[model samples]
Target: YSGSFLYAIIDWSFGQKCNRHRIRTWNAEQRLICDLLDNYQVRWGRPVRNTSEGVEVRFGLQLIHISDLDEKNQVLITNQWQIYEWEDEALKWNPAHYDNLKDIRLPIKRIWQPDVTLYNYADTRLEEKRDVLAIVYHNGTVLWKPMSIFKSTCQIDIRRFPYDRQNCSMKFGTWTYDQSKVDLKFYRDIEKFDLNSYVKSNEWSIIGNRASRFTEKYDCCPEVYVDLKFFISLERRGGFYNYILILPCVLLSCLTCILFWLPPESPSKLVLGMNIFTSFFVLLLLLYKNMPSNAEHIPRIGAYYCLNMGMIATSTFLCTIVVHIYFRGSGPMPVVFRKVFLEWLATLFFMVPHTNTPEHHESYSLIPPNKAVCGGDKFEKFELLKERFKSLGDKHLRTTNNDPNDENIELTIEHECGQSIEDPLS
Candidate 1:
């Protein structure tokens, strides 16, 4: 009968497992796989805990496990406190014991992460008694899932919220002060129990909801309406801001171009060149100071440095041309040569047309015209002399014709070279 009773008990336990539909439900099967303490014993003990006074205390629970039984009648016991509850009547219970009461699997059913806020002990005058923070879990329903569970302005009561504050004081924490009656510093923990991470996720959410959502209600029906909004913007890449630094580099690069216009022979060209080089170095140092050292590739600003160097190189070339011409010393140039050279240089520089013509050549002669033979007065005098000579010859012929009253025949000297005798008196 005892054996039969034992068999019946086993059958009942199996039946209870089947009723839960372990085979039909995948979740049940998964839960069954981890159900090592189905009838386990619970143990109570004290773990080291820190108090507000910075002192450590021993407090814990002890448990004995009873559920790990197999068909072979092998029973295993575990000391882990799988199922334990606090009895407030046991005055030994500290407020910190509430941390161990979390539902490890409750996160799956929550629409949003669970959060806790505590009631102000000072205001309620229940400093250590009723200052319990209530846990809020967003209910994921068909209608609520589509909406933001934690929005810019969602309902949250400070009376039961838990916050984690680490290095940042600007965020909300469990130890914040409501110094200003009008406003209070809100604290929030990134995770449930971590004290190192703080978040300011709710402040702007409250302000944003006031502007909109005149009549929107949340699950808890909180007194204050808060709409959810993301206060801080996401971090953006700074490649464009890095690109902005190029402007100064370009301006400095342009300064090197001034060296080109400086008179080649003047001392200013070398001085300007050195100054430009110095500026390039200075800019390089500034860029280095602003940027991280040990970089492999050059930044966009470095390209400006390279470009300025190119300008300096071009200036150096121009200086070389100036020096070459100055040292050649071709002596004082003739007017014609100077004109031609200037015209060629201008044509080369300005691309003008050459206008020198042959008549304008320097080697052409300069002389006055010989017009004596072609003069009008000289020809008239010569004709008169000829007429006088002919008249004298005729008078000589008349005297020889024997006119006694006529002047005596004064033969000057008749020298006959080749003249005929008949032509003497006719």
Candidate 2:
């Protein structure tokens, strides 16, 4: 009787396997795969075994598209690869008798999926519900593939600006389950996050990527939550900024240097300087509008602009001083002033003196009657006059035998009109 009972148990197991095969073949013939969905209870609360060893939900990502990278809102959109551990009791069968079937397609609503969410999501719409492709094996392992659009928050640091690189991340895990029940694992060996596979972006380029998994322990809950994070490194495509913003600003900066070469007496010098300064101020305002208001750490480009504006302001101040000095007293230039500015600074800066009118030149002509000096060559004539003044000063000292500070000796080189002598060459 015991032998009979053992044989009966073996026969019953074999009969069950045969029945399962028959049912699978019938479903495939009738185009009734949906009926197989009714065979098991898929809406279980937990898909993992109740033990110390938590469920390992393998996760990965493949970038399909980059819809937008909103700087103002600080958000980005991409296709995320969704995966999880599913209960095998709901869907499992032998492949040999079911026409060697290894996979099946089912409406995603028919299976139980983890309630995962992007904690940094910026959109109001919920994740889409779509069909899932399931690959089953003899060992009762199910691989489910479901694709969805993820609009996640990305903290942008534009301090480096046009030449800046950015690192953005996407975090995924069960919203409710603790690490003790369900854990996330990065399938780094089997999956790859390829930058080349992504749709090219106009404003940014993919540089590199990384993946990691960890658990966060909350103060309120004793159970820690598992997290899977993926990082994508990107570099800004700076061609736009180079041509539109930076190029114009740089050209304006170069134009400012021209002001230093302009003649101090010309009204156009001041007008041109003022116009360049105004343009710089406008560019500064435009930069501020596009950048964050945080004033703690200024960008390198911003510092460049500030320095440019400062130089222009310094030039304006120096121009004012030049105008005042040019229109000052009509008397001859002081010996010390002429020696330091006209002889030293003017030569160092390659500044040429403006030529005086014929009437003014005739009054102080130092050249011989037979030699005709080049017109408007005031710098050369000024040197000759400087030497003549020194000689006259010495002769006066020997004749008067008076102190060098005596007003009469100092005023010895008076004009024919009895006025103080003026440096006509300047």
Candidate 3:
């Protein structure tokens, strides 16, 4: 039985070996192709010609993801498309089965690639380099896709803030070569830069994109340098700040109006006014902390904070004056003050007068004589003493009429007896 089993295994092994012959190992084929092209000299520029036409390096960018937009550092993290394609005569292949070999992945060092760099980069660290996938055709056309992460500088304008929109650009150009050696151009005729492939960001929304190419000429060299510019329009997601920062500030600002409704005589009115003012000051500090420290342009929200703080300060000052006036019992009410603040302004603001009650009316009638009724000069000493005595007698009569206690009635009888005796003696 063991001998028969060994014979059957040998037959199956031989049959499977014949079937394995038909299968091709792509890894071994790729190694063979690499060895063939290892000795090829890859030229980094155009074929030498007397004409001005230079090597046209086609460039394009496909935004994949937005890692971050650091407003504080003025930097941005973007995973983007970096496609560099220029005709390479040394890198061409003719696979026996052309239809089966669509593309190949090879170490980028084996072929020539442009030394393109972001001119506005904020970080000095080199981007991570890896093997690039290349598509080889019957002709010598080689399409290369290199992995890249762009950390570029962007000037952020946060004046509008929450509702602000930013137009940032990533500029690509050859590091050392000018237009005479190599020129850059967009990949193809792209009507609108598509963003459907990009990962959506929670903090910002991509609105639109545009691609443009321009050349810069310097006075020192007649050679023109070409740059391919990619413009990305971004609008801030305002829902967060609208509810967290703006709405609270607006509500606190509106609360200052309620101070007017509080009775001026209550100590709580002053306490509440102070508390509101303190809150306004704290909100202003928070606004300053969140804003960039640029003196050239102030944000509109900052202006609103300033205005609100000014209003709060003004209200506080007026509240102090109102409390003083409400409790002031020693000094005479100035005639001008009585006419303006007590009559016209009070009525206009719907503030009910305290002098309407019977007790208050009696006290109001005892107001000190106006200086205008004294012939526009200081009163004579004799007349001043006479007016003082008359005021004292009026106050005594009002007190006796309001109180009917036994002490007040006895005092009144004693005053009558003394007056009768003094009258006969005089």
Q: State which candidate has the highest lDDT.
A: 3
Every model's Cα RMSD, please? Answer: 33.7, 12.5, 14.6
How high is the lDDT of residue 368 in model 3?
A: 43
Q: How high is each candidate's TM-score? A: 0.27, 0.67, 0.69
lDDT of 3 by residue, 1-426 (tens): 998698667534433322234335445454445433544444344433444666678888778888888776778888876776676555555655444554555445555677778888889884744455566543456677766788988878778876888788888888778987788887765523446578888888888789888899868777889888888888988898887678977787667667655534346657876787777677677767755675356667877777877766665666566445434433344577556655565556554433223353244335442221111112232244335435555554544445433233233222222222221111
Clashes of 1: 45
Question: Which portions of model 3 miss their true places by more than 4 Å?
Answer: 1-28, 42-53, 97-102, 130-135, 191-194, 325-329, 333-426
Clashes in candidate 2: how many? 0
State model 1's lDDT.
0.29
Which ranges of candidate 1 are over 4 A from the true structure? Answer: 1-254, 331-350, 353-426
Winner on TM-score (1 vs 3): 3
Return the lDDT, model 3, position 279.
Answer: 79
What is each predicted model's overall lDDT from 0 to 1? 0.29, 0.60, 0.61
State residue 394's C-alpha deviation in candidate 1, in Å.
59
Q: Per-residue lDDT for 154 in model 3? A: 80
